[model samples]
Target: MPEGIEARLQEFDRKLRDGHFELLRQFLAKDYFGYSPGPGEPAASDRITDLVTDLKAALPDLTVAFDNIAVDAEGNATAEVTVQGTHKNELWGVPGSGDAVGWTGPVSIRAIGDRFAVRLDDLATPQRVGLVRQLRLVNPADEMDQPPHFPVVWPEFLLRLVFTGEVGDRPCSHLDQITVSDPPVSVCEQCVESDHIWPALRMCLVCGFVGCCDTSTNRHMAQHYQETGHCIFRSIRDDEGWIWCYEDDAFFDKAMLDRVG
Candidate 1:
């Protein structure tokens, strides 16, 4: 590993912590690719810029600390990063509670010459869920407010199922029709083309069509089911692996699927 890799990584971390996103561009390669980008963000650099901008806006006092940065001879680097800040503004539709919140997870960076050509932050899902919990956005007692839809307060529903063992209903026959389990694309193509935001994404199990969840304004997944008569879909959201059947109005978690299978 080049000695400059560690120095560049440290500088990247410092720039991010200082909210100097524009200066951080020197650490990224021209062909850099991040984990996933939103509707209008076409380039990986754009995705990183938007993410940090939103984070800074939501948590003005945000701080990021990177530790245990190790780089191999192949120029692949890994580090543990902890992000901490005060929730002072709205984030992902959750109103800020003015409370201190944080999450720690691993991150990967690949050195290309003197800049990083790839960056993958593994903390997004856990951080969002932890922030929601800290803001008291999820309430297990508010079952009435939770519709049969998959994305609404889904973490709370999962907690209830795990602790109470309240398996709602039997699996629908559509599970047999799940021929495609993986999503071909990360973003909803329709949403990207229309420049619309999708709260979450789903994949049609029958034909592997990727669409936005029902909570999105477009409800592209539901529309896909309606247009193609494909009823079974699975969540492709971060850290979510549950299945839903629109025709049967049924939901199945990984545990339930294993039990029934």
Candidate 2:
């Protein structure tokens, strides 16, 4: 192991564990790059700082523990880290459920001068999925009931369909419930009133109510479904005409209308 590398690693762990995020700059290179799933590009130092800040805000009592740390003579290091926290605020698109959530993953660190560049394990997808599950955004029982090959592709529409039973035998149970197809407004009214911006829009098929998609911070569409039992909604953004069923957890292309009719 390189001289002082282990001590530096320990200091880095202490800084993060103690929520002294500002001190992290002392351990990270000026051109530090961090890698994780989702964004295809490496995250710059500023983005990494923002992410950690957001994480701390969401989990007020967040804890990070490093174990099995191994350092090589060339200043390359690997360690297994476990993160634990209680969901006290909204994270990603899911609202806080006050659930204690934890995930363990491997991380790599390479010393560049006195600073280090960190990269999370590429197979952290399961950890993310598990985190969402812990937030109660996904139901394991419902997932078990889902078809083996869910979101099956329909060649005619070139879109995926997630439905139960044989496609030829019966259509989506919510398909016939659609009472409205056209949206009356272009903007998410809730977002506008709340002074928030939305990335996309969805209109309820049952009541023609327009709201923001899940990607939006407000997630007005999901709130509308929970409050009104309105199960289906269609995208009103761009030319993408896909419909989603909140009850069935399925997706359907607008072309499905022509096929069934």
Worst 10 residues of 1 by lDDT: 160-169
lDDT scores for all predictions?
Answer: 0.64, 0.65
Q: Per-residue lDDT for 1-261 in model 2, tens only?
A: 576888888888888888787876677764433322122322334445655566678788887767888898887898987778998987554566788889777777777777776655544334534544565544453343222222212221112201211111113578888889789999988788978876568899999999987756788999999999998988885467677787775655576676666
Report per-prediction Cα RMSD to one decimal. Answer: 13.8, 15.5
TM-score, structure 2 vs. true: 0.49
Candidate 2 ranges beyond 4 A from true positions: 30-43, 122-125, 136-261
Off by over 4 Å in 1: 30-41, 117-128, 131-261
Please, what are the lDDT tens digits per residue for candidate 1 over residues 1-261?
A: 656888888888888777676764677664443233223324444444555566678788888767788887776888876778898987645667798988666667778677775443543444434544554554333332232222333442333222222212324777777788788998889988998866678999899999998656788999999999999988886477677888875665645555556
Consecutive 10-residue window with the lowest summed lDDT within model 2: 161-170
